[model samples]
Target: MFFADNLKFLRTRKEKSQTAMAEELELKRTSLIGYEKGVQPTFGVVMKLADYFKVSIDALLRYDLSKLGKFELSQIEQGFDVDITGKKLRLLVTTTDTNGEENIEMIRHQAQAGYTQGYNDPEYIESLPKFQLPFLSRNKTYRCFQIKGDSMPPLSDGSWVTASFIQDWNTIKNGTPCVVITKEDGIVFKLVYNQIKENQEIMLVSSNRSYAPYNVSIDDLAEVWKFETYNAFEV
Candidate 1:
């Protein structure tokens, strides 16, 4: 179902003609056309397409790859298939300890810039400092980010805020405190006002009254994490 649309989108995004791409994949132009027109592909042919696109067979078939942003697409092209479902989706690259328990990666002020680009890279994620919180749920993924500036008061600057990954942006409630990772803004801690249904954007508001709220299109969003708790620094 999604495969046909996803195939057409990917091909168009690559700006390749049916004949050209078919030739590159050693597939007949007609076969490629049929595949784009909803005809089922054989497992071997599926494998070929997967290899050509640098995506997983499961993602190529099950996920709507076209709906993802460029950052997310690049991640998929690198063979990191996102497990989340829905229209707006992004991969959550994480590392596990020797016991196979998930580790919480810390993204400090120094690592914020690289995190935006390397968020989907497993190696990059694994390289970050990691630890686990006993109180946090084991089933969910968590990441700690060091907050900076006076934008958020109670949390204070240089404090570490550990948040859980939010797979569905639609589930984000209005005025919810979250860590939003965007293309334009590397990582921001804000009170999110979900406007996804009406405008395909979410309004980011600062806890401090001095800072004005701004809108960020969902297209610019790479990841969203619901605020769990923070470890405030001594003032």
Candidate 2:
């Protein structure tokens, strides 16, 4: 099992002492050592470790390559038609050609309909074409929004961005760009770096080297969404 290697990497990167990590997980130092030494831990212990590290079991075990086929199959098995009512949705830009531009127009029309719902039924769920985004295996519901800042630089600007919900944190990697929400600010997209400490602090690194990284407390985070990609409208 790659558990030992994974544990060691995470522990060293986090700069966490074995004893300290063990105490937090209610595990003995010897057990933690064994995990780092390639001892295959039980499923329960593996789950606990995965939770402690804020990673998926597959990620912690480094089984992504071996389990990709199985993971896709599992997603298929679990996939089901979801009703749009009460479920959050966003629009994703699929292409940049004329067809893609037409799709954006269609989305705008739907948004207008939803906005003018008072003329009919305010709760009516407007149906729009659904498209699957690359990188993200799951089909995402998207909504179009205007990008207002240079934080995302070349990728986003005063253009349309399709925002989607991010439910899993394990898929997030250090230094990868993402849209994060805190209790204080609703949404801000930037590169996220794993902080040195396990405390609430997280380093929000900007892609533009000119800007400095800002530290934010984890307790203030309400949501963190990965910016899959974007289509920029030239100004």
Candidate 3:
């Protein structure tokens, strides 16, 4: 079986270290190292790896996917070009409260620059200020962003916008307001126009007519939070 080699190849191809991958998958680093060294994994473990890597069990265990070309591997994976688009399985790094419920971390205006750098850092996420809303449904993850500028009207600068985390971009509806986190722009509140299917891009339209609409490529998107409500007053 090519499982051992395949595991190592897939992890490295994603540019993730064994320790990071293990933590993301909730596995021990030593165990992941052993798996790469040819220790047979349980059926459950194999299934988890396959799902995380977005590969079929048959291909992961039987085929040497590392030997395949980018186009060929993309064909096997299906959907978007996973190799170049950076649209892999995104494991959201978050923090929880004492009762084990998810906490809504606030990304303050001053911390926006730092957030872009430490977005994936668990410690950084945990360090942010967090709170909960009684009205919000517990099933979905929520985040609060301190938005700036007059791009999103009615809600002025420094207003707090609480949003529900959207895992799949395909589920977003056209003209829906959202808090879009991107590689180029840290975070911005805009009306989203879905274009992922046709162009692998989304057009972000600002409510304020002064600012022009812009296109954000899928490769640049870090996170998308559906707009729930906002606090017009300063928090």
Say which candidate scores most in TM-score. 3
Off by over 4 Å in 2: 1-136, 139-145, 233-235
Q: List lDDT for all candidates, in order.
A: 0.86, 0.54, 0.85
Cα TM-score per model = 0.64, 0.40, 0.65
Cα lDDT for residue 173, model 2?
64
TM-score of candidate 2 to 2 decimals: 0.40
lDDT comparison, 2 vs 3, better candidate: 3
lDDT by residue (194-225, candidate 3, tens digit) is 87656667899999999999999877888889
Judging by lDDT against the true structure, name the best candidate. 1
True-structure RMSD, every candidate: 8.3, 12.6, 11.8
1 or 2, which is superior by lDDT?
1
CA deviation > 4 Å runs, candidate 3: 1-80, 83-89, 232-235
Comparing 1 with 3 on TM-score, the higher-scoring candidate is 3
Sort by TM-score, best first.
3, 1, 2
For model 3 the local lDDT of residue 178 reads 96
The number of clashing residue pairs in each candidate reads 0, 5, 0
Q: Mind giving the per-residue lDDT tens digits that candidate 2 earns over 1-235?
A: 5677768866775699999999999999999998888788899999898777666675566433222333332332244211111122222223333454322211332243342332123233224333434454345533344444676677545555555545444345688767665556545668887542333355897767787889876556555555655654432
